[model samples]
Target: MGRQRPPRLPPRKMTGSLPTVILAGCGYGAIDALRALKGQARVIAINPYPYIVNSGMSTRLLSGRFSLDLVRIPLLEHIHTNGAEYVQGRVTQIQPEVQTLTVQTELGRRRLAYDYLLVNVGRELRTIAGIHHAFTIRPAEQLLAAQTWIRDCWRRAAQGDPTPGLLTFVVAGGGCTGTELMGELYDLCQEMSATTGIPLTQARWVLINRNRYLATGIAVEKEGQNNRFSRCIETGIRRLGVEIWAECQVKAFGPEQVWLEDGRELLAQTRLWAGGLQVPQWLSECGLPVGPEGSLIVDECLRVKGSERILAMGDCADFAWGSQTRRLPKIGVYAVRQGPIAAQNLLRLIRGQPLIPYRPQATAFVCVTVGNRIAVAKKGWFIWRGYWATVLKNLFDWLYMRNLKPVRWREFFY
Candidate 1:
């Protein structure tokens, strides 16, 4: 006897008579927007994960100073406490014409309708050939996996494994993430060497960057066609016994080999990629106008072009300043600054009032932490590097996390 399959259930509608405002991603900007629109509208926050990871402190987590619990903010609890609904699912499709969203959840596929939508899903790591075999810096959770891999390598070295590359680590990309990661990895290796009675020289670390300079994102000053900031950072990193390969690109990654564009191959058991980022394909597929990098094109008021009901911020949004073709850098600080503006604009949109434009700062401040409690900071033509700079960076990160969750003072230290 053949049994009939279970009947397919209809899509569950997730709205009432009240106007709903959907927060597409629970990122920095979305969190602030949720707080602003708490009592003004029926706010619903949707994300695949139940928590949001703090990327600023991700390297601290990798270096074993911060715990996983400390870096993750309880998004579900925060939303429910603020009188908003939380949906644990991935937004598969967005039908702007119908004001409907297709979400894939555990129960089944559900269709949600909203009067307004705010997107800040953030960007995903750009992939290269054989990227699957290497660790990436997006999603923030992969840093934990890399931490575990490092511990395993230390364990093998402690047991006198004669295999080469067991203690070798390679980081591709010299951007903020890759440089910070390399610094933390250097500190981690030093700690492991001290604990395992292995000489630190036995551990190898290499940082590869396609650009001619490291930390290219930082504000640069040209002194006879030379970037002063990059030169300073390069000297600091080299002093830490780490190798820096400039003007190099990683072609592919294997189990223990990294192939370079110049036909050079390097063997390393642990490989990490933090090269670049791109928006999710589904964002462009949803019929919204996107820029070159697949980010939604937002106007001066943070509203999507040609749509009043849609707004976007963060790395998922492409916003250009007045009369400028260059878009703002994809950084958390800019997203934080855009949150309140997005929320206020949403309120004004609902009340049929005039929307305010978001003015991004011309010169943004940036700080990159090196190992041994040292950091480099730059803004416009000013540059600073020292322990005090590290202190300032830590203070900023601590305040940011403390605002999101109740964090203990001890969590910031090892």
Candidate 2:
């Protein structure tokens, strides 16, 4: 099938007297907020792309199991159908003092005024030296290119082109994204080996992590002690014939080498980096109260610190979990939970009603896909893995995208 194109939205005539709620970025939280604000306020969503890519299924897209069309939700059609305006542009500047935004669009720069603003720009992939030569798992579009590159490598290897590192794939991190990617890459290589009649032993797969264990930052506790989720993940990936290099850091990437911080190098033609993530630098310079990692500090009501008319969530906002001042993890589950609350609070703020404080769930479900029809899931201290876990992950993804559809279709399908 051909790649899907986002529909071009015509210039909307601003005729409504309703208060305008501008969503800085149409991420998971912002999209949910947009749905709640429908018909209540004039909503304008500003995003660089006319569609939102679901990052949860991104590895599947890279493995060629999911297509671009399946992972991307076209924003123009849904926003317009829900009584909102969509602006395809990058937010250049935020003049909070004047309650306005300067967006750089295809035509030119445009100044947009709003009564309330919701910032959910999200985070970008962290980069290292010579990162331009390696594939970073972000922008969602880049995964398509990586997929094409893998196919080309397979073709060359099948024809006995004798290219160095032709079947070697190196993943430069053992975080969730990196782990999933390594598993999928291994699966792809094995499939290719079977199809091209090449020996599977000829291919090499490596995962490099700076931490002592895989998924170091993830919270997996059981009875006041850490659980075995990380250990399980490490064992699972290793069983797939992947070399795990713990406590290792990548210094840079050369033409066909992954340079290590310890002065060692690994030769691999295809390199994938999933080191870390960081908020946009522009966010810190926007004069907003920012916390760690330059994420905007948000209060209990999901409002930006000291700003009544501005709210932030998702990876772009540093939201405290409780009185202890621990920030919530930058994940889709938190954003999904915060979306409706943020929208409701925005409406209450406008109506002079008592706003509700957002209290995060005590324990959230976390799941990571390792390979085709294989996954690991955790909730509190309980852990599950294998095909059943993968099923649960797919169900979650399906429900998220299904809810993004118009109400009419949702009701009909139900």
Whole-model lDDT per candidate: 0.82, 0.80
Candidate 1 accuracy as TM-score: 0.91
| Tens digit of per-residue lDDT, candidate 2, span 1-414 | 112222222333355577888989888866667667888888999999988888877877677777777777778877887789989998877889999998999999999999889998888888899999898898777777887788788889999888889899999998888888887787777778788888888888899999887876555234232337887788788878889999999999998999999999898999998998888888888899999689999877788877778899889988875445666778778888988888887777656566677877887778777765578888887888888887777777787887775322222121
Clash number for candidate 1: 0
Best candidate, TM-score-wise? 1
Show the lowest summed lDDT stretch of 10 residues, model 2: 1-10
Once fitted onto the true fold, the runs of candidate 1 whose alpha carbons sit more than 4 angstroms away are: 1-16, 218-226
Stretches off by above 4 angstroms in model 2 are 1-16, 220-227, 406-414
How do the residues 45-160 of candidate 1 rate in per-residue lDDT, one tens digit apiece? 99989898877778676677677888888888778877999899888788999998988899998899988899878877788999987888866768788888898899898998
